[model samples]
Target: MAIYELRTYNVIVGKMSEVVSHYKNEGWPALAKHPQKLVGYFTGDVGAINELIHVWKFDDDADRRAFWAGVYGDAEFMAFAAKIRPLIAQQQNKLMLSAPWGPQP
Candidate 1:
């Protein structure tokens, strides 16, 4: 089964653009290099003040675990995260296994 790593970040009003831009400009490059990351980005939406959602696909649970362990321990990633910390209000995560009932192929 294909697993999806979902992160939803709530950012301060009027700062979502900044949050988005920061991820694109600085964060994405480093994340793109990660072997387990299939896709990552932020998208605007309702029900939240502002949203930064990232979806990462992995081959298996071990792959995902290794990737996150390294990501959380990386100095550069930590720095990048710090840069955006003050701009965000909260963050949530969901780890899901894809289902056939989801959107059509």
Candidate 2:
């Protein structure tokens, strides 16, 4: 069965702008070179402020591992990551499997 990974990063209160700009200019561009596993990226509007959330789909756990391995091996991505990391206050990740009756991402 396929799997999905949900990543949530809580940005430092005033660093959202910095994080956003960096992701726009550097992070996304670096990540674009890898296999396109991303489903989408989102930011909170009302209740969940200062959070950056992204979803990704993979064929299996091994595929997910390989995908991240490729991403981590990229120098540009790692550089972007170094810039972004300090701005993130906390992060949460979850792996999920689709329910049988639902429309899938």
Which predicted model would earn the best lDDT? Answer: 2
Candidate 2 at 71: error in angstroms?
A: 0.4
Q: After superposition, how far is residue 58 of candidate 1 from its true place, in Å?
A: 1.5
Clashing residue pairs in all predictions, respectively, total: 0, 0
Q: Estimate each model's TM-score.
A: 0.80, 0.98
Worst 10 residues of 1 by lDDT: 40-49
Q: In model 1, how large is the Cα lDDT of residue 2?
A: 63
Which regions of candidate 1 are displaced past 4 Å? Answer: 46-49, 100-105
lDDT of 2 at 81: 97
